[model samples]
Target: MIKENVNYKTLDLHQRDEWLHFVMKCETYDVFYLPQYVQMYEERGEGKAQLFVYERRAEEFVIYPFLKREIRGAAEGEVYYDITTSYGYGGPLYSLSRLKNDDDFVREFRAEFERYCKAEGIVSEFIRFHPYLETEAGLASYVNVTSVGELIYNDVTKTEEEIWSEVAPSKKRRIKKSKRNQVEVIFIDGKDIGPKEILIFYDIYTETMDKKQASSFYYFSLDFFQAYFTALKEYITLAFAMHEGRVISANLLLKSEGAVTIHLSASFKAYLHLCPNCNLRYECILWAKRNGYHIVDHGGGKEKDDSLYKYKQQFSNTQTNFHIGKKIHNQSIYNKLAKQKSKLVQGEQADFFPEYRQVLVTPRILSNK
Candidate 1:
C-alpha cells in the first residue's frame, strides 16, 4: 500500500515549498537549491523539472526534494533528483526513521522511479549524483554513482602571511621569484573586463586545458556567463594573472556562504616559470578578505600531489575532504556488471574523473581577478 505525488507541474508552488521546507529541515538537509534557480532554468528554454514521489499508506510520503531535467535538452543548472545537490550537503535531508513499511516502501519507490526515468528518459549525467550521495541505497536508481571531490581548502580565512608561510619552501621561493619577474596579478569581476577583453582570457584557458589533456564542463559558454552575472553576480567573481597585457592565467570563483568556490581555472605552460596560477590565487584570497568570502574549493584535478594541488594548497593550507557521488540510470545492472569485471581485475567503479570531467562553461571561465 503505497502512495505518490509526482505532478510537480500540477501542484502549486506553495505546496512544493512546504514539502521542500520540511525536507530542508531534515538532519541531512542542506540549503535549498534556490527555487528561483529551477524557474530560471525553465525560463532559459533549456528544459523542465519533474518530481516523482512514492508514499506508503499510513506512512506519509516524506519527500526528499530533488531537481530534475529531461536528458535531451538539459542545461547546466538543471540537475534531476537532488535531495541537496547544490547546497554541497543535500543527501537524505530527513528520515522516516521508523516506518512500519520501510523495506516495502524502498522497493515501491525504486520501481516507480525507475519506470518514470525510463518513460521520461531523464538525464542522469546532469543529475550529478555527487560521490558523497552514493552511500544512499535509494538514490542509485535515479543517478549515476561515481567519484568526485570538492577540491576544497581546509581553511578559508588563514591570514595572508599565513598563506605564504604555509607554502612548501619550494613554492614559497617560486612565488617570490614570480613577483620579481614583473608578472602582474589582477583581481576583478565581470565588469572589470570589457567584451573585447574576453578573447584574451579564452586563449589562456584553452592552453591550460590542452596541457592537462582535459576539457572542462564549460569551455566558452557566454549564456552561462550571462546567467551567473545576472543571477549570482553578488556571489560570483573571477581572477586573472597577467604578464604585461597578455592573459597568462585565470580562475573563476563563486562566493557563497562564507567562502569562494573555485569553479574553474587555467594557465599557460610557458608562464609556468612565473607561477601565475599561484600568484592569481593569492590575489583572490586577499580580495576575499576585504569582500567577505573566506573559503575556497579549487575542485578536484588530476592525480593529487601534482603542481596544481601544491599551488592551491599553498593558499588553502588545509584540506576539507568531500566526494562527488554519481548514480547512473541503472545501478543493479551496472553493479552486477562491475562485480563481474572486478572478479577478473578488482575494478572499483567507472566515472568522469581521471579525465577531469565537468559540465558547465561560465563566461567567467576566464578570470576577472
Candidate 2:
C-alpha cells in the first residue's frame, strides 16, 4: 500500500550536509550516494546538479542526484533539457526499512518524478546503477535498463593464499616478473598527500587519458582532485608504484562499509612493459584482504570482452553485472529534438538517449596499458 500525502523536494549541491544526513538514515546505501562524490563533477563545471528528495513521511526519504544540461545548437535557438548521473555509480538511494514493499515505493516515486519532469519539459534521464547495492527489479520496466557489462570483484574474505591461487596464470607470471623488475608499492594517506604527490598522480592519469584519446569529461582539473582528496580523506587510500624513486603508476581506492572500490588508476606509458599496473593491483588486493575489507570492486572495461576486461579478470574470478538505466518524458518533444540533432551531426546519430547529444560519444581505439 502506498502512503498518502507524499511530498517532494529539490535541493541543489550546496545543501550537501543536509542531503548526506538524509542518506545516512537509509537502511542501505553506498559511498557513491554521498553528496561529496557527486559534487566532484559539479565542482568541475560538468553540469548543474539538482538533488531530488521524495518523502512519504518525515521518517522515509529517497534521494536522486541529477545533473541537468541544455541540448545546444539544435535549430535556431531551440533547446531541450536532458539529465544524467554524474560519473560513477548512482541511481536511487532510498530507505528500505521505511517501505512495506521497496519495488512498489520505487514505482510510485518514479511515477511522481516523471510527472514532475513532464511538467518541466525535461526530455530524458540516464542512470548508472550501483553494482554492490540492492535495487528493486521493476525499475527496468519504467526505464530502459540494460546490462552494460560486468564489474570484477575480488572476495577479500578468503585467505591470502586462496586469493593468490585464483589469479590467472599469465597474471601470476606478470606479478612475479614485476617483482624481479623492482617495482615497489606505497600507500599514501590523503591527509599526508601534498601538491608534489598530487602532480605526480595527475601527470600520469592525464597522460594515460590523452593517449587513449579519452573524452573531455575524463580530463578533470587538478583542483577537482584536490577537493576530492580533501573532502573524502578518511575514505580515500592512494597506492603508488615507484621504480628507482620515480612514480611510475598510481591508483585511487575508496573504502566504505567493508568494501573498497578501485576508483581510478593510471600508469606511465614507458613502464607498461615492466608490469607496474599488475603489481599495483596485486598490492592493493593484498592490502584490502589484510585490512578487513569484504570486497574489492574492479570496475568493468570499455567493453565486455575488451583487453581491459581481460586484464582485470586475471585478478579476480567473481563478476557482477553493471546496469545503465534511461527514461524519456515528453516523447513528442524528444522525437523533435532527436530528429533535429540527427540532421546537425555527421553520419547517423548514435542510439544514445536524447540523440541530440550523440556527438559526445567519440571513437576510441582502446589499448592495453
Candidate 3:
C-alpha cells in the first residue's frame, strides 16, 4: 500500500539492467551493491534479492538493496519475512545531485520504508552499514544503531612516500625482510584465474581457516569461488605471493568505483617467518594507488583489538567505525516469534536483535528431588 505522492519502484534480480542503472547513477557505490554480486547470494539460497528505490525526482533518489528471507513457521497460512544485507556492508545510498537537506531526505525515506515493510509483511530488518560511507548516523532517529568495531584503510590518493611513512616501523622491517627473502608478489585478474589457481587458493584458505578454527561461515565451497570469478571477473583481482617457485600466500581484492577492498586473505602456516603477508599488503597498496583507487580497505577483525585487527593497523592508523542497524516494523509478529524462540532456547537473548534468529542454546534438565 504505497502512500499518495510517494514515487517509488521495486526491482528484483530479473531486472538487472534497471537495477544496475540506478546503482551506477549513485556518486559512490561499491561492488557489494551490484546486482550481479547480490544475485550470487540469492542463487546460494540466502534469500530473494530486491532493490527498493524511492525517487524524489528524475535524478535524485535513494536505492537500497536487501535480501528478503522468509521466516519459517512464524504463522499459520500467512507468510512473513525479514530483510538483511547480503553478507557484507550495505545500506541505503542516496543521490545528492539535487538534495537540499540531508536530514530531511533521510527522515522522509525512513517513513516510507517503514510503510513498505508493513505492507509487505516484513517483520524486521538488519543492516551492516558501510564504514566509509557512514550512512548509519543519519538513520539514528528511526533505526537502532551500534558501533561494532573499527576498520583500517589507506588513503591511496596520498603520495607514495606519505603512504610508506604511515606504515608501522615494525611492519616496514618485516616487509623488507620478505623482499630480501626473494618472495615475489603477482597479480592475476579474475578473468585469468584458472582451475589450478582456484585449487591453490582453496587449499591455502581452508588450511588457514582450519588452523585458526574459524567459524563454519568462513569455509566457502570451491564452486563459490568459481561462480565469483565468472560473475565479477572485471572487479576481482587475485594477488599471490610466490616464494622459490611456490605460491605462499594469496589475497582476494574486490574493486569498486573508487576503492579496493582486501576481502579475504590467507597464507601457509610454515611460511609465516618469511613475512610474505606483509609484503603482499604493501604491494597491494601500491597497486591500488597506481590504479587510481582512493582507498584500500583492510576490514576489521572478529572483535576490537584482536590479532587480526592489530595486523591490519600495522599498515595505516586511519580508522573508521563500523555500525549495524536494526529495525522492527511488525512489533507484534516480532514479539511472537521471539517468545517462541525463548521457549526453545535456554538463555536470555535480549541483546540479540530479532531474537528469534539467535543460535539455539541447549536446555539443561533438572533432576527431580
Candidate 4:
C-alpha cells in the first residue's frame, strides 16, 4: 500500500524501477508492454515524437504502461507501446492474478490516469488495443479496446521427438546438408559493427518482399539504426549467415525476459533453393533453447491456414493464438468509419503493419541448429 501526492515530472530511472515493481506484483505484469520500453522509445525520440506516462501520488508513485502518441481523430493523444519493440497489440499490461484484492490499487491507478489525462488535455485512442482488459478486468469509459489483430507464439516444450523427426524429409535433408554449404552464422554483440550490414539486410529483404507482392512499412535510413544502436544493442542479437565473404542471410532478433523476438529476417533469392531461410530459423531455435528461452516465436501465419502455417506447424511444441477483440469508446463514430476503412485495408493485404494495409512480405530463413 503506497500513496503520494505529486504533479508533473517524468519518471527518473530510480522512480521508474520502483513503479514497475509495484505494478508487476499488482497482477498486470507483462514485460513487453511495460512503460519502460515506452520510456526507451521516448529517450530515442526526435522531432515531433512524444512519450507520456500516467502517474499517481501515493506511498509509492504509480505509473501505467502507456506512451504518448500523435494521431488524428477526435483526440490528439493516445496510449501506445513502443511500436518497434512492440510485436503485437501491446495494449495495457495488466496482471489478471490480482483482480480481487487489487480494488484499492485499481481505484488509485484510474484516479491517477484520469487526473493526468485531464491535466495534459489528452484523449484516448487505440488503433488496436489490449485484449487482456476484456478478459481480465473487463472494460470502462477510460479504456477502449480494438482489434489490431492477433500474434502467435510456438510452444516447443511439449513437442515429442517423433513429431520433430517427422518433418518433411527433403526439408530435413536440406537442414542436414546445409552445413556443407560454406556458410557462416555469426552472432555479433551489438557494438563493433557499422551500418554497412543494415543495407545488406534490406536488399535481401526487398527481394523476398517482391516475391510476396508486398511493400515495406518504413524503410529506415542508416541514421535510424545509428540512433537507437547503443540502447538497443544491449538487448538484441544481430545474426548473419555468410558465404564466401558474402552475406546471404540475416536476422535481427531481441532477447528479453528470456524470450527471443524475431524482428527482421531475410536471405538472398539465390539461396532460397538451398532452403537457407529455414536453416537460419532452425539455428535460432537451437540458440533459444540452449540459452534457456522458453519459446521461439516464428510468429503469425496469414490466410488463417496459409502455407506458413503448415511450415511452422512442423516445429510447434505448442501454439499461442491470441483472440481478436474490440471495444468502441464511441459507437456512432466507429460504425461510420469501420466499413470504408475495413474495405481499404483488406484491399492491401498488409498483415504486419495493421495501421495501414500494404502488401506484406513474409520472409523465410532456413538452417540447422
Candidate 5:
C-alpha cells in the first residue's frame, strides 16, 4: 500500500520540459509517451494532452500520458471528459524495475488514479497498452484488460545472420525476388526529408489507402505529415523502395530509446508482384541493426491473424500480445451517457466502450500503428 506521503503530479502541454524529463527517467518508454509526439495530436484537435505521474519515491514512479477529450452532450451544462492514449501503444510506464511485481503499489496507484479522475470529471479512460513493454499486466489486477491482438517484432539484438535465419522461407524467397527485380531500398533521415520527398510519400501512401478503401482516419493530410517530419525529425526515418529509379514503396520508421517501429507504410500496387515491401521490411531490419536499435515493431493488424498480421509474421517469428485497458470512474454518469447515446443512435455497437461516443458518423478509432 502507498503511504499518505506519496503524491501525484499532472503536467500539461505547457510543461514540455518537465514532461520529457519525467519520461526520460522511466526505465523504458515509447515515442508515444513523448511530449512532441502527443503535441501533434493536440494540434489536430484530438484533445488536450496531459501527463500523469505517480511518485512512490525518488526516481520511482509511474508516468501515464493521455489525451483528455470532452464528452459532448453527456449532460446539461455539465462538462465530462474521458482520457485515451494516442493512436499508438502506451500505458503507465514504470520506473522501478521491480514495480511490475509489486501488486500493492499498482493497486494503490489505481485507487489514487480513480480518485483523481472522479475529481476532475473524467468519466473513463482507454489505454492501448505497449506490446513490447507489457505495461498492461501491471494494471490487470486493477483495471479491465483484454487481449486485442498479437504484434510481430524482430529481435534486432541478435546478429544479422541469426535474424535472417528466423525469417519464414516464403518471405526469404520474396525478398530475394525483390532483389532480383532490382528493388533498391534507401533510408533518409527525417531531417533530410523535404517537400519533394514528402510529396512522393504522400502520393504513394494515399494511393495505397485509396486502393484499400481505408477509412478517413487513415488518410492523414500532407500538412500533418510535414509537421510529423519536423517535430520528430531526430527520431524518424523515411525508408523507400525504388524500382527503375521510381519510388515504389515508402515507410515511416519511428525510433524510440532502443526500438524502431514501422509506423506507416505503403506500396504502389503495380509493384506488388515485385515484392517491394518484402525487400523494404528486410532492409529496415538491417538498417535498424546497423543503427543500434534493438527491436523492430511491425504492429498487429485490425484482427488477430489477419492478412496484415500474417504478412508481418513472415519477418519474425517472435510475437507479443497487444492488450487494452478500459476503466469507468463514474458509473452513474457513464450509464446516463450511454442511455443518451442509445436514444441518439439507432444501434450502438455493444463492444464500443464509453458507449456515449458511438454516433453513426463518428469514425471508429482504428489502429494505425
Candidate 6:
C-alpha cells in the first residue's frame, strides 16, 4: 500500500526545536508528545529517543515520537531492536495544514512507514494512542488497533452542582465526608513547587508503587520528577490534600489546550480512611472547571474492568475509549522469541506480544488498584 519516493527519516536531537514547532501547529497534539517529555526519558537513559518524520510525496508530513530500546530476546546472547511509544499515550501527530481530513495521505504515510520499519529490522512497534486526540481510526490501516478501555473525564462546562450530581452516590458522600473530616485540598502552581515538596511527592509515589508490588519500570527517581516539573512548569499543576496541615495525598496534572490530564496521583495508606484521595480528585474537577479547562482526564485503568476505572467512574459519567496499536515487522525473529518464551512458561497461558517479555511482567502487579 505504501508508495515509492516518500521520504522518511529520524530526526536527531539537534532538530528537536523544529519538531516542537511542528507539534505546536498540530490540533491533536498533547503534552506527552512535547520535546520536554521525550527529553525526560532520554535523560533517564531509558532508551534512545527518535522523532520519525514521514513526508508523503511533497505535500504533508507526520511526526512519530518513538523510543528505540535494545531488549534481550528469548534467544541466548541475542538482542532485538524494538520501538515503543513513550510511557504515556503519544502516537503520531499529523500536520493540520497539509493533511487535514486527508485519509488518503494518512494511509500512504503509514504504508511507507511500515516499509521503513521492515527495512530496518524492527522486531515490533507498539503505540499507546493519544486519548484526547481521537486519531485511532486514521491509524487502523497501519496497525492492529484495539479498544483497551475507557478513560473517565469531566465536562468542565457543566455547573459545579450539575457535575457533582453525576458522580456516583458513594463518591458524593465521600467528598462531603472528607470536607467534614477537615481534609483540605489545595493546588500549587508548578513553578511554586520546590525541591522539598517534590521529594515529599516522590516518597508517597514510591510507597504506593512498593505497596502495589509494581514492576521496577514504573518507578521514577527524584531527579526525573525535578527535571520534568521544572521543564514543564507552565503546563503543570500540583494538587495536595492536607489533613491538619500534613500532606496526605497529592496529584499531578498537565494542562494543555483547555484539557487537564491527571498525570500522577498517590495517597498515603494511613490516610486512606479519611478519604483524602477522593477529595483531591473532586477538587481537581472543580479547579479545572473554575480555571477554564474544558475537560479533566482521569486517565484509565490497568484493564477494561477494574477497581481503578471504577474509582475514576465515581467522578464523571462521561467516558472516552483508550486504544492501543501493536504491530510486528520481523516475523521470523518474533516467532523465535515466542517459541523460546513459550517453553519457559510451562503452564500458564501467555498473551504478551513478542512473548519474550511475558516473564518480565510481575504477576503481583495485577491491577491498577
The number of the candidate with the highest lDDT is 3
Q: In candidate 5, how many Å is residue 199 off?
A: 2.2
TM-score, candidate number 1: 0.59
**Residue 27 of candidate 2: its Cα lDDT?**
79
Q: Against the correct fold, how does model 3 do in TM-score?
A: 0.91
Candidate 1 residue lDDT tens string, 180-243: 8777877667555544445555666666665555544334455544554455544456677778
lDDT agreement of model 5 with the native: 0.85
lDDT of 5 by residue, 1-369 (tens): 233554677899899999999888888778899999998888878899999888878877888899999988778989999999988988888886579778888887787787779778998888889888888877766778888788899999999899999889999999999999988999999889998999999999988887777767688888888888888898899999999999999999999889999999999988899999888989999999999999999998977789999988888989888888888877778888877767532221246776787546444444556
Off by over 4 Å in 3: 1-6, 97-101, 343-351, 360-369
Error of 2 at 121 (Å): 2.4
Estimate TM-scores for all models. Answer: 0.59, 0.89, 0.91, 0.65, 0.91, 0.89
- lDDT (10s digit) by residue, model 6, range 126-228: 7888877765657766677878789999999999889988888898788889999999988999889889889989999988887778777888999999998
| Residue-wise C-alpha lDDT for candidate 3, range 1-369, written one tens digit per residue | 235766566799789899999999887788998999988888888899999988777677888999999999889999999999988789888776334247787777787888788778998898999888766757888888888789999999999999999999999999999999999999999889888998899999988887777766677788887788789998999999999999999999999888999999999999999999999999999999998999999999988899999989989979999988888888778888888767543222246777888775433333345
Please give the RMSD to the true structure for each candidate, in Å.
8.7, 4.1, 5.3, 7.5, 4.4, 4.3
Write one digit per residue (lDDT tens) for candidate 4, span 1-369.
122563424443446665555555544433444445444545544112222333333333333344454323532354322112233344433434444235665566556655554554343333233333333243343343333324444444434354356456656677666667766677766665557765666577666555565434333344555554454665677778777787788887766554676666777878765556666766776666666776566665655667766676565445544433222233333333334355543211233332321233553452344
From the highest lDDT down, the ranking of the candidates is: 3, 5, 6, 2, 1, 4
> Can you write out model 2's per-residue Cα lDDT over 197-280, one digit (the tens) per residue?
888878999988978898876777888877888888877889999899999999999988888988899988998888888889
Against the correct fold, how does model 5 do in TM-score? 0.91
Question: Which regions of candidate 2 deviate over 4 angstroms?
Answer: 1-6, 73-80, 97-101, 343-350, 360-369
Model 3: ten consecutive residues of lowest lDDT: 360-369
Error in Å for residue 209 of model 3? 1.6
| lDDT of all predictions | 0.50, 0.79, 0.86, 0.50, 0.85, 0.80
Score candidate 3 by lDDT.
Answer: 0.86
